[model samples]
Target: MTANPTATEPTLLSLPAPDEWPHWMGARGDAQLAEARRLVDDLKAQRPSEARQVLRVWNDAQTALSNAASIASLFSEVHPDRDVRERAENLMQDVQKLDTDLGLDTELFAVFADLDDTDLDADASRVLEHTLRDFRRSGVDRDEATRARLRELSEQAILLSQEFSKNIREDVRSIRVRPEQLAGMPQDWVEAHPVDEEGLVTVTTDYPDVIPFRTFAHDADARRELVTQFLTIAWPANDAVLQKLFAVRREHASLLGYATWADYDAEVKMIGAGQAIGEFIDRITALSGERAERDKAVLLERLQQDRPDATDIDGADATYYAELVRKEQHAVDAQRVRTYFPFEAVRQGLLDVTGRLFGLEWTPVSQEAAGTWHADVATYDVARDGERIGRIHLDLHPRDGKYKHAAQFDLVRGVRGVQLPEGVLVCNFNRGLMEHDEVVTLFHEFGHLVHHVVGGDQEWVRFSGVATEWDFVEAPSQMLEEWAWDADVLATFARNEAGETIPADLVAAMREADDFGKGYDARTQMFYAALSYDFHVHETPDLTERLRELMGRYSVFPYIAGTHMQCHFGHLDGYSSAYYTYMWSLVIAKDMFSAFDRNDLFDPEVARAYRDKVLAQGGRRDAADLVADFLGRPYTFDAYAAWLAE
Candidate 1:
């Protein structure tokens, strides 16, 4: 790929340089909004006889706005320059408001309302159906005052959500400890954090530092200190932010005839309503309870070795003690296992694994050619049978202002004969050696990237790239994590500096050790899921009390007083009332994985069938239909049940 570009070309594909972001964002954003509004006016004046013609214009306008919005949104999270990031954040709110305004346009809604959906293809019909539903949800039929109020609330919600995330992203808390406090930490990790002139190591709550610290460091007090700081991220700042957000959302939902935000949020998801969310949490909790207790007992037993009077394991000690059990009982030494996985190797291995499975190839694209925001970001062109299909960018390290967690963000939606899709994977992992869990996380996020690329080649932008129901979006990614656990899979890519592949027995032990934490993990997810659901369903929300009640009810660890876990829970803003999606998606993921032959991780027949049936379907079919198309039956909780029981 060439880096050179004609300076006069639009800056959308090749993102503007940091200094040019504000000007480019403002100019391009206005162009998109003005064009969309003009298109809506044109459509109102001259209704096309053919519905497809109307839809084509509708899709194009929406797509233009979406592309601009996606860029602004992504840059807000990953841009290193604060001024650029701030500009992006503000632009995103404006773009969101403009989009919401378009959705509420009565005249525009009527144009779609009158479209004859008969004799249309699946993708076109699906797009029409969703558009009509969305318009109603946007209050298109409401009175002028009501519509104006909805718009106001929508803008408020977007701004508040941004503030919530911004608070967490900017607030990087840390604790200092002596070298002795890092006794059980990986040597590489300890070396990476050199002692300052004060002779103390600084550990921040960034994922690269905090996760390993919690999982390995021996000093309980230090672990407690770090964990407490980690949990308190964006605390009091987010408290008010969350309060205003909930108020805005509550009013918005009420105006829309929804009883609560939870009800409104779940209407379009696989999970139907707030009540069902509670049932789901309860059902999963029951399934994992017995095993969770056994795990707690084992962890507490390990804890008592250090403190004879220790009664229970707290959040700070959970991962530390769990590692002790894994090494002693399952022969899975996490620190030893990490030696085989460096970030670069894991990165290439990930491409190789997915490429083999999907009959695709990935070729590196230079940063300049890709017009990336940072040097650390790497780009790849995806192809099948020599025909380029899509592209992906990987941003895999921690920085002061970067997003604190891993996720896949869509930069472009591949509309066949229009534009090819592009997705970005933003994560935080150690640059050299990586934890096994980090490897799995890498695989998981890439799964979303793969879905976006493979599923993207759709006739309409609406049906392109991981556009499935929100709750089902994580299944493909979660299922891909299974590959990371396979011994053969690990042997292919996980080699140490000495070039020794991980032993099959070691992978086996790792898998067994992995099973040990499932119950606790599942229960912890339940706690978050409960908190997510509880916060939205009620008329009045006491954020702290709700967080405390849910944590105590479902978590293996007791809630630390004065700590506001919800403040740091970024999903509360993104997923809103549906953080249960992770668990819900995992149930589907486990079920989907059962179709694979365990011995052949790269079975072409199974791989191709899945790629065509599931990934290629995108949002054209219902998620359940897509799952059934591959599995030859509706997905069930059986596989998930069996997994939890393991």
Candidate 2:
């Protein structure tokens, strides 16, 4: 690894107390931004012969800036204290402005252009190439006035994104229900929400409250009411925010000589173009067409058993019927499955599974060493061969004002010998027992955690961790989800309070039941992919209307009026027009998993090979090359297609 030349050792990242956040974050961020500017000035004055050294210095400075920004941004999403979260959000905007300014620095671009690419090693060459490309994409080559406008637009984009997410996070709508409305839900779930003085129970749109209610609640009106609230999250307010966001992005793309925001966004991804995303979405939809129809038929038929006069079902009814089908036909009750998976057990089991597969050890980190914003957060140090590799934090339960989804956020990028990688997995699940689907999510996010740790050993920070193509980032995590389904893997950790492992037959039933929803699930994802794509590709005035159109085209369920799903579609902010990346990456994941022997998922030799060939390469190689190296061939869609058909 190349030394930073400016520092002997980089400071490890940690969350400051809420009271100290504003000061610590403000001072650290200011210093890092100033240092980055100073390095750019140094690079501009350096002789061509010193290009390599000066570039390394520049990278070191930017790395520091990135770490500060990332840590603050992560806390902004997951911190329990609202004021602290807001402060962190403001800090994140400052970092985004600095990043935009750096990207648009023509002098820095000129300095890089003067360097000879042949002088650098393979990894460094890739870094230089990507940097130059990014500069061009950032409009560094434009006139001064245009560059200034780009800077303004970039900052606006950041603010708008923050607003969109904040609206969703803050809006937690609820409904009151009678005790009879809780029928069919688990006894524990029912007990958790005791009747109030009015002889009513309150259910909120939080995942823990809403998911089971939608799946198991017998009262159709109660389920539909809750679904309406869930789907309309951040409705009228985000309506305007989203429109402004779209306009700003459209103008940003227009200024950069692209037809649409989607076109501009797709340039850096593996898919290469917006039109190609449409094609991919169409292809997947076709692949799932037969299965989706069959599944929809079964669901519609099941609906008729209760409502014989009903001709169709809405999104609210889909989950209930699907669970009913799983219980009746496949003999797997989701509520019963939750009994085996206690939250704490699943956490340890995940650590054990990954550690055994990758030949690593994990030990708890003291609170003193790993400062946290919340007590619910847990910290660990990951080690391989008795050497500390990275630090990871798990913030894995629901709370008011927390991010409403599960994801892994990188707190620090690991550049070997310079700093240790740090990541936090933020999730919302019940604190006691977890739903089986929640277990899958945990494994999936942990896959990303493992990727960040294993891939952080690269010499250049730019190529470190999950810094690969934006489109390929989800593949490793998606691939890791397979472990959640394997009977042997489940037996290791899934247990009841009575100390009994989950029955193998029950797992088989769960597997069989899982097949029942494939068609509808695939179509649902296609709807999301299409919605994400069309919103950027087509400049429609009515996002709601366009969303409805896409829903009809891609989803099996008809659009439910009065639900503005786009308001709470958070990916429209972060992922922008690249939501198709999920499906694209899944294709690669399935193909790669084909290399593993299903009967022996714990094969050390195969696991080690995957670790070295895929995760360790990081962004040093193209994603295609990385996969080919591990599989001895390029990935194909056959695996995904077969899975969808099954």
TM per prediction: 0.97, 0.98
Candidate 2 clash pair list:
none
For candidate 1, what is the lDDT? Answer: 0.88
lDDT for each candidate structure: 0.88, 0.88
Q: Candidate 2: where is the Cα deviation over 4 Å? A: 1-3, 6-11, 17-19
Q: For candidate 1, lDDT tens digit of each residue in 192-309?
A: 9999999999999999899999998888889899999998999999988988888898899999999999999999999988778899999999999999989899999988988999
Q: Which portions of model 1 show Cα errors greater than 4 Å?
A: 1-12, 17-19
Give the backbone clash total of model 1. Answer: 0
Q: C-alpha displacement of 556 in model 1, angstroms? A: 2.0
Q: Write the per-residue lDDT of candidate 2 for residues 357-472, one digit (tens) a residue.
A: 99989999877677887788899998899988888999998888899988999988987677888888999988888889989999999999999989988678888899888999
Model 2 has an lDDT value of 0.88
Candidate 2: residue 529 lDDT (0-100): 93
TM-score of 2: 0.98
